[model samples]
Target: MARNSADRLLRQFLLKAIGPIRRLGIPIPAKISKHLQFRGVVDVSVGSGASFKMQSHGHAIENRMYWYGKRGHEPETFLPWLEASKTAEVVLDIGANTGLYSLGAAATNRTSRVLAFEPVPRVAELTRHNARLNPSSNIEVFELAVSDENGTAILHDPGGDQPASASLRGDFLDCKQTEIKVRCVRIDDFLSEVNLSRVDLIKLDVEGIEELALRGMRTTLQTHMPTLFIEVLDARPELMAELNGLLNMGYQVGDLCSDGVIPYDLSDKKGVERNLLFAKDLSRFQ
Candidate 1:
C-alpha cells in the first residue's frame, strides 16, 4: 500500500515536470530522457484535443510519441490513417505495436471498433493498458500474431530499446535477443469466430510476415474489400508478389504522400520503404 502511494506521487511529480521541460526546449538525450522523464505510464497530448497514456520507457512507439506526439511520429501514415478511420466502422490493426493506430482510430471515430493484434506479450499488455486510460472503449487488443496458419509460431524480439520490431520471421531481426512462442490466427478464421461479418479498413504492419498475413486474410479481402494500409520496407520481392495479386483483385496500389498518394509500380527496381494504400478507389483519401 505504501509503495502504491509513492508510485502515484512520483507519477504526479513527473507529469508536472515533463511539460515545463518540453516547453523550455531542454535538449535531453533520448537515452537519458527514457529513464528520467518517460518512466511508467505518462499522459501525452496527441494534438487536436486528443490525449493518450503511454509507457515512456522500453517501447519506441510510446517513446517516439512522448517526445514528438502523434503527427510528429509518422505524419505520412498517421495522418492518412486518421483520415481513413473517419468513415470506417471496423478497423483491423495487425501488428499493432503499442496500439497507436488502434488508439488513434478509436479516438478519431467513437463508433468504430478497433481490433488490435500484437504478438509481443509485454507490448500487447501495454496497448491494453493504454486503451483503458482513454475514455473510449472501442479498442480491443488481441495478443496473437496474424499469419497464414492458426498454430503457434516463433516470434523474434530485437529487444533493447526497440520493442516494436518483433516479428514472426527469423530474418526480420539480425540482433534477435530472444524468441517467443505466440499464438497465431488467420484474419478470416478469427473474424468468423468473433461473429464479425464486415470490416471497413485494415492496417497491416507485421514487419516481415505481411505477405503471409495477407494470405491468411484472403477471404476477408475478397469478401469485405476493405481498404488496406500496408507498410512495405525495401519492397521485398516476396511481399511485392503478394501485392501484385492484390492489384489483380482490383486494388490499386499507391504510396501515402504528404499531398496525395503516389502510384506504386511493381516493375520499378528501386522501391523504397513506405506505407502503401490499397483500395478499389484511390480518390477517397484525396
Candidate 2:
C-alpha cells in the first residue's frame, strides 16, 4: 500500500506540527481539528466545541483534540437526527461517552428529554460536566451501566493520554488498572423508575455490552419501538444474535453509511464492527 500525497502531508503535519503544539499546551481551534480523523482527535472535540458553544457534540466534545487549531471528527450517524429536530422526543444514550450524542441532543429544543447512561466513573463525570456546560434541564446523567442484570462489576481502566474503554478486556499501551464502582441496570428497570413510557431514539456504543443492555430492554423494545443507533463490535457473538433478534422483531435495519433501512441478515457476518441503525417505521423520518 502506498500513501497518497494528501495522506503523506497529513501524517507529516500530525507528527511534526500537531504533536509539538499539543506538548506546548496550545489549544487548537475547531476548524483545524477536522483534518486528523483519528479516534483520539475526535474525542477531544467534545470539550473544545462545548467550550466554544458549538452544537453537535461529536468526537470534539469527548477528547478536545485539535489539528492545526481545529476540532476533530464528527460521527455521521447523528447527522440525520440533528437535521430533523421534531422527529425525536426522548433520547437514550447508552455508553454516552463524554456526552457527545447526549449533549448534542440536549442542544436541540426538539429533543424533549435525554437520558445519558455511562458506567465509567470518569467518563460519567465528563458527561455530567458537558451536560451542565450546555445547561439543559432536559438532560439527565446516570453513572450506571446498562446490562442484562443489576450488580457491581469490575471495569478495566486503561489510563494514558487517551483513557477510553477501560472496561474492555485488553491491555492498554499506556494504561493502569482502576476499580470503578458501577451500577448495572436494565433499560426497563431504569425507565420504570423514571416513569418514562416511551423513548423516541436510542443510541448505544458500549463495546461488547450492547447485547446485554438490549436483553434487559425487552419490554421497552416491544412497546415503544424507538429508532435505535448501535455500534456493533465484531468481538461479541451475543451482540450479533441480538441484531438478528431485532430483525426478527419486525424492525428495519441499516448501517450509518446507508441511505435507508435494509433487511438485516445474520448469515452475512462479515464486517460486524460497524455503526448500524434500526427503526420500526421509516415514516418517523418523514
- lDDT tens digits, residues 1-286, model 2? 3568778577557746676776676766655555544332222222223322322333434334234222233444655444333457888888887766765566554347989887777667777766765664378989887888877776666554234565534342245577666678889888989998888888888766778889999888888888888887673577778877887888877655545434455566774777777877655443
For candidate 1, the lDDT comes to 0.80
Q: How well does candidate 1 score on lDDT at residue 229?
A: 95
Report the lDDT tens digits of candidate 1 across residue range 1-286. Answer: 9998887687568657776876575654666445444556755554567665656663555656666566546778887788888889999999888778888788777798999998898888878887887756588999999999999999988875438678887887788358899999999999999999999999999887888999999989999889999988767787888888898899988788776777778777665677889988887766
Name every residue pair that clashes in candidate 1: none
- Runs in model 1 deviating more than 4 A are 1-51, 58-60
Scored by TM-score, the top model is 1
